[model samples]
Target: MGERLYLYGIFPAPGPQHLALTGLDNQPIDSHTIEEFTFLFSAAKQERYLASRRNLLGHERVLEAAMQAGFQTLLPLQFGLTTEAWEPVQQELLVPNRDRLKQLFAKLQGRREVSIKVMWEPDQELETLMRENEALRLERDRLQGKQLRMEEVIGIGQAIEQAMEARKLDIIQALRTALNPLAAEVIENEPMTSAMIYNAAYLISWDEEIAFGEQVEALDAQFEERLRIRYNSFTAPYNFSYLAQP
Candidate 1:
């Protein structure tokens, strides 16, 4: 078996068809005499096959299908990793990295990634801030009764800018407190922007989806009255079932 060529991923046992579809049609995974193991190989070398999109898709399909069948797969090699033969994969990479791989798989098993975002149109928020600023109201009232200088008009513009800044900070803080707990980790992608401010988050856990949905639903009920703040949650865009944790 040392001389035989293969690319291996440590997936939960009880599969052979998975191995077959993933590129192991000629070789049987069950035949390996190694303890608690399964492996797959087709005609091409393991490294060469992983380099193409079609092959990478095939690999992910195998792993995801296996996971759906109650098998937890620890994909050691990413889509583009290469190996000369099975021995090097087993003896060199897999052996030296055994503990790390096990820990990674342990963390990834039975878990999925969910992403959440809070976004609002900047114009909506800006309009809301303008309406809520008492200073603007007072300035308008004073200007209504008297002839205003250019400096007074400039001061009003500065006041609006200050009010907008304060409003942005307050809203961001409120959203952070409200949504951060519902996620395992929150990654702010766009931060606060002039067009649309957004907070992106990654939630990890099989159980978190429902809890997160519930939180979004509850927040919707509370913020719906305002009609300015909007929030949503969704699965991340990666095809991999488990997102590599940092």
Candidate 2:
């Protein structure tokens, strides 16, 4: 087909015209100034990009570099976003949403996204739940190795799953309570696996990053034996920006 551009991020205009970074296909990253905002993108030889591990990391590399290249603030675009030309991107997406984009950029300035992932052994959580929730424990005991009808087994399984979800929610709330005071915004994304009890991204100001780390350390110390608590303090604020989809 004709030319295509892989969009990465947007920040204020008058940024370095050259990104000093390479993105997909080892292409040089560059900028296209649109109004008061500058859009960062790279030329794509492929018609479109698939979300393979290599391709995804390549996309993120440029976005991360965009922030590191003196502009700490950025509105990270979605992965695999492309346009044949900037005309459509401007006429439809950027120009229409200019004000909101600027406001988001200003709000995101001086802040970075911090990620926290807490995972626990599912078997352990289940055992704890069964012990703490007597009704669930009784249900599990009643259903254990029983020669029951399909519907009866399914019902018992559903009940156990519901109880497990409720327990996960309580733990997520405690995690939020422990970390919310240090964050400008906290977003709880759905846990991807049964072992995941918490997956959240926090917008933390640069000045408070050390305090945030201390808070996370205390939380980890509290649950060191039971849970796997991990945090990364430096990333573009995607969750709290225009890049986030409704």
Best by TM-score: 2
- What's the lDDT for residue 68 in model 1? 55
Residue by residue across 44-133, what tens digits does model 1's lDDT show? Answer: 344344356766656556545445555544443455444445665568655665566556556556555554445556567666765776
Pairs that collide in candidate 2 are none
Q: Which residue ranges in model 2 land beyond 4 Å of their true spot?
A: 129-167, 243-246
Q: Candidate 1 — worst ten consecutive residues by lDDT sum?
A: 25-34
Q: In model 2, state the lDDT of residue 8.
A: 88
> Which whole-number lDDT from 0 to 100 does residue 4 have in model 2?
89
Per-residue lDDT of 82-195 in model 2, one digit per residue for the tens? Answer: 898878888988867877887887788888899998998988877888888898788779878879999988898898889878977776777788789988888888878878
